[model samples]
Target: MKSKGFTLIELVVVIVILGILAATAVPKFINLQRDARIASLDGFVGALKAANSIVMSKATIVGIKSAKVETNIPNTDLYVLDGHMSIKPEHIKAAMNIEGFMVTNYALTMTRTTFVYLADKELTMPELRALNCFIHLTRSYTQQDGSNVIDTGDLKVNEFYDGC
Candidate 1:
């Protein structure tokens, strides 16, 4: 006799194989979030570096790179931080000028140099730890204020993506 349908044992075996495949696939899918977060932060870092270069070039050309504004960055109130060789953490919005970006988490710590950001807003503090999944940007002290930016190795961008 020819079987018109799959036997119960065959169906069970197929289901078990599928279950194993699904189990493996689930982990890969879950890891996609981590990868996405990393990529996003990487992009952010690139954008930040590009903005720094632009500010640096403008500073070099126009002779304005301090924490104060000698002249606006063509059209914005961005006072280039030549001291840190980057814009102030507070001026990131003005520097990047991306639409709908709210870097509200940025604030000067007590030392007024280091700033840590969650990078991914969807992440919660309790999910891991605040410091674990943070992207840190540190600005070193410089002598110039309202002056042009020079390459002094003052900008430090570090990421601790342990919990991401």
Candidate 2:
């Protein structure tokens, strides 16, 4: 009588095919987390740029030389967009209008004049916390024709991709 089951050779061949497929698929899956982190960082950068532009426009309309607009968060000092004052971590959160998300999802650390990101332990890998990722905002004064002019510093992202 002929057997109605797969032969040992046939079973081994099927297993080999599955293994090859898995080997190719696993890399794509592993990269998903990195891609997601990169996207999140990019989104945050876009938000920062948008917020800065809005604040600057408002300041210009109000005839203020500096970013002296009220923030979304109460009891926080006004953000000086003209670079007269260094932006604080709270200022950044308020400017981005993502205080709730930041509070719930990530830890913000202030080092000198830079804001650093640390992923929450419950939601992210410990390696992310050790990565050097930060944003820096600085403002300086320059003398132009014997007059002091405030020069706004651009926002800089450092080691953002390294963490991802």
Candidate 3:
């Protein structure tokens, strides 16, 4: 007479296989969040670079000497200054899908010779959210003697967006 289930080795082998599969699959899933964050950061950097190029190019013709970029309060889209431009949040949203994806919280400082932009992004799980962006502007003036001087240090960022 033989009993039905006396196979400890079989159970152990099954458990080992399961563990191996889990070990391999878990890491890939966990890494997805990190990839999303990197993508978001890249997009932001690209947009900032684009805007900087635009400002520098147009300044000479517009007599903009120096200017700061601003946005509507409590939002990322709808830029104001010279004209309005639309910024699509979808790219960011797709990457992070954070709770509050509409607002931007970062700061910017600019001069005819230099411009600085910074963002305080809060990461949740795999998502990133921005707080605010402030900007400052300075102007450069050239003298007939071929001397260049930088003037006007008015660092102002118009009200726009809430910290979500």
Candidate 4:
């Protein structure tokens, strides 16, 4: 009699094909998490740049040369650009916009002439954490032509791809 269903050989072949497809697809899905984290970090850097520019423009308009400014937050001080209020870690946390991220640390050194924002704890992946992935925003003030000027050195991202 003619067979009514797939032969054992055919079934085995189909199963093997499926397994191959899964092997390839699984890796793609796994990489998505790493890509997502990288994208988030890039977005944060962009936001920081925009915020800094806005603050600087405002400060220039107001002729303020200091990096200290009064912010909307009561009892808290923030950096200033040109006279405009600049953003700080506290503001970012209060916004609660970024998921799985925190402002890990903030410090001023060199007699309060340098400011640093550290966001490291956001990287939750074991590999990334082991790599010590972090983001840094540093600003230094300098005396130029008898006026204090703010110099944003760079936004740094420390991420090792192997960890991701």
TM-score of each: 0.70, 0.62, 0.36, 0.59
Candidate 1 or 2, higher TM-score?
Answer: 1
**Candidates arranged by lDDT, highest first:** 1, 2, 4, 3
lDDT of 1 at 112: 33
A best-first ranking of the candidates according to their TM-score comes to 1, 2, 4, 3
**Residue by residue across 45-158, what tens digits does model 1's lDDT show?**
788788878767776676665544224655565656543344455577667754423244334342234334443343344543554655666655444565634344466777
Alpha carbon lDDT at 36, candidate 1: 83
- Give stretches of model 1 more than 4 Å off: 66-74, 83-86, 97-102, 105-131, 142-153
Model 2, span 1-164: residue lDDT tens = 98999999999999999999999999998799777766766666677677777665555555553443322322334465443223566666655655323322233432224434434432342444456343333333345687545344555555446655
- The number of clashing residue pairs in model 1 is 6
Query: Candidate 2: how large is its RMSD?
Result: 6.2
Candidate 3 residue lDDT tens string, 1-164: 78798599999999999999999999998677555554544454455445545543444344443333433322232232323221223322322333422333233332232212233443332242243222222333334555544333322333212221
In model 3, the worst 10-residue window by lDDT is 155-164
On lDDT, the leading prediction is: 1
Alpha carbon lDDT at 133, candidate 4 = 38
Better of 3 and 4 by lDDT: 4
Best by TM-score: 1
Q: Provide backbone clash counts, one per model.
A: 6, 1, 15, 3
TM-score of 4: 0.59
